[model samples]
Target: MSKADVVAGIPGAIGGVPDGMASGVLAGVSPVHGLYASMAGRFFGGVGTSTQLMVVTTTSASALAVGSTLTDVDPDQRSGAIVLLTLIAGAMMIVAAVLRLGKYTRFVSHSVMTGFLLGISFNILFGQLPSLLGAPVRGSTAVAKALHVVLHPLDFDWRAAVVGLLAVALLLGLAHTRLRTVAALFALLVPMVVVLVLGWTNIGTVADTGDIPTGIPLPHLPELSSLSVPLVAGALAVTLIVLVQGAGVAESAPNPGGARSSVDRDFTAQGIGNIFAGLFRGMPVGGSVGQTAINQSSGARGRWGGMWSGIWILVILVALAGVVGRVPLPTLAAILMVAAARSIDPDRLVAIWSSGAISRTALVVTFVATLLLPVTAAVGVGVGLSLLLQLNQEAIDLKVVRLRVHGDQLVEAKAPTALSDNEIVILDVYGSLFYAGARTLQAKLPDPDGAHDPVVILRLRGRTSVSATFLHVLGDYARRLDALGGRLYLSGVDPRIRDVWTDDLLHAQGIHIEFFAATSTLGESTLAAYADAEVRVHREQRP
Candidate 1:
């Protein structure tokens, strides 16, 4: 590795310390789990990812997702549940990669995703309030706990709040200076030193929650007993979150060498990383946006930058395992709070809000769902929103344009509102013909009533597939036209579409109509269908 790669890895590794531990707190587990994830993800993920500089690590979103996944498990079973959840999510991700399902992540609605992410950021900020203030509160949800903390300011422990707020201030201040690379480290260190000097035994430490293990993480078998339907569903949600975030990281941090990264390869890389993290008794890990930015900005020269990051984390773990436990909980909370604040993108939110009611509704609903519901349910809501947006677009986008054969060049115009007697109309369709789109097209088609002996030819060029709904719409339209002494003809139909259409009951109904398969030359099928229509019209008009 070059000196540049080695140097770049240092900053990322240093930054990973506080972020990893804080992420562990976020996941409602031992801070060391996040530490383990940091090391394991970088070690496994960095080796195989197509994006060489991409650092897979403990991200806040993935941590919160882990917490939500194990919310219902018994306290004693949580450790095993964490491992099982991570393993299931990893397995699912590898399956997705094997099936070449990476490209479809792009279809996720931008507005919905933005809303979900923003909501998660806010949730993180709110959830950390109790720890940040060192206040005891009772509430079922993050929002409620935050509200209780807010309403009962007198209950706050001023000492813990000062420590947390001091860390926050230092983080914000150093962010503008050249020392921003190590600001988080100082944020944790300064507060711990102050608390130690003051002898504030009341302030909770990382050790208060659990024992801090020394040395490198080792592999452990997952508790197969913890596996359940709920765990499987939650794992699916975790998989969705990681894959989507991985796609986003790729977009933000492109390869410096102008090499295009394979999405599926990166997906598989994350899967392997998570699998290793789980085996090593770590929290869930993924392509972290913050750490990837850190690696890139540090001038990472190659894949080794990321690989060395894992090594650096291991070095720090061995050296400072004792000091790490002495770190204050409030300081960790402060680090997470600052991260949450920086994560919000107001400009994007405003842009989505200004787009239209459809966009605004998606953004608002997703944001609300994320706040009020569990993380897995929020993810489901976001997915449902995406499907709704897709169906809405398909229905709105479908259009029927009239195409007239003028000598050699076909002329385009608005389709007729109603077909006329002894007339031939050629219509070309645009947009999807599936589900709601087919229904929309059926509604927009020209009425065949009072149009005797009329012939309408629909050009289906370039369409290799059709939904069953499309066939039903066609059957109904054909029956209408035939009942009015008219006929509907399909031109340029693909052989595959013909096969399906021929097998359905709609084919029997289509007997009154005719369909012509596509040919090598463009418009050949339509032209032939049109000529036949003219002959049929003339024959019908003959006394």
Candidate 2:
């Protein structure tokens, strides 16, 4: 790595240390695990990732998810469970990569993601409230914990609260000044010094939780004896959270030279990072939006910046393990609270509300579901809501417009209030023809009454696929027309659809359905169908 890369990595490494430490607390693991996770993720993930600026590290969402998953495990067994879960999640990510499921990330609609992030933000704030107030609040959900603190305020430790509040103030206040780069560090350090100088015995430090290992953790496999369904489920949840969050980071942090990054490659990179992190007994990691942004703004030119950031973190872990132990828990809690608060975007919520009722409902349902349910369950709810939203939109947008040949041009024509004997109608079907949309098209079609042997020509040039429901509708319409001694012509049929449509089956039913090539112009197909309709009318008139 060049000198410039090292310089650029300094800010990222500095910011990552505290952020990772905070994530560990969120994950209900030792703070040093967070540091190890960041280091392992950056080095391993950076080497494999397509996006040079992306910094893979511990994220708040994954951390909270881990904590929720392992809440019931024995304290001593929790660390091992965490490692096993991370490994499982990493394996899932690798499977997703090999299956090339990255394109499915597009299905995660903006409203759903917005709602999820909002829910996670709330979780973080409420989840960290106990630490922020230095209260021994015990509950499963963030709301329950907050309620516990409120109901028993006397249990709060004033010294720890002071440290947390001061850290928050410093972090928020210094962000507006020139010291913003080092603001988090200062916020942590100043509060620690105050607690130490004043001899605040009631305040808990990192050492209170567990000893900080002086060197890198040796690679080892977590015990598989205690593995259970819940652990596997949690790993699946973590994998999804990582993929979604990583996609966001990849999208937001563009390469300096403007080359597009491959989402699947990045997915594989994060999987590799998680595997190493698990082996090192570190927390699960993904592409961190905050850290990546810092790396970019710090003028990082290539992947080496992220690689060096991991190296610097390793140095810190070895040289400053003793100092890290002395850092107060509330200070870290304060940092996390501020970061969580920043993640919640009220403006985005308002935008979702104003977009439309369907979109607004999706946002609200996902948000509420995420708040009330575990992160894993909430993902299912969000995906279901997204599907419903898509169906609703297709149902509303499906249309069948009448077309007429006016001189050399084929233009849209208003459907006549009534049809005349021997008249032919041409219709253009638009939008998706799947499920509910097909029903909408069937209902919107003009009636064949008042016309003797009337023929209907449907233009379907752009559609690539047809559902069974749509085919059934077409068959029913063709039979109705056939009974009237008329015919139905499908003009401009896409080859792909025609291949799947089984034309022989419909012809065997005496429906008299004729299909025009997709390459045929709409005017040519309509003229051909019109001539055939004229021939049918003449035949019907013969006596």
Best by TM-score: 1
List ranges where model 1 is wrong by over 4 Å: 503-512, 519-521
lDDT by candidate, in order shown: 0.90, 0.85
> Model 2, which residues run further than 4 Å from truth?
415-421, 448-452, 505-512, 520-527
lDDT of 1 by residue, 1-543 (tens): 799988999999999999999998898888888888899899898899998889999998888888888888987788788888888888998999999999899878999999989889989988999999999967878899899999999999999999999999999999999999999999999999999999999999988878888877779999799999988998899899999999998888888778998889999999999999999988788999999999989999878898789889999999999999999999999999999999998888888989999999999999899888999999999999899899999999999999998986678999998988888999999999999999999998988888898899999999999988888898888888888788889999999988877645555565556989999999999999999998989989999
What TM-score against the true fold does each predicted structure earn?
A: 0.96, 0.93
For model 2 the local lDDT of residue 269 reads 94
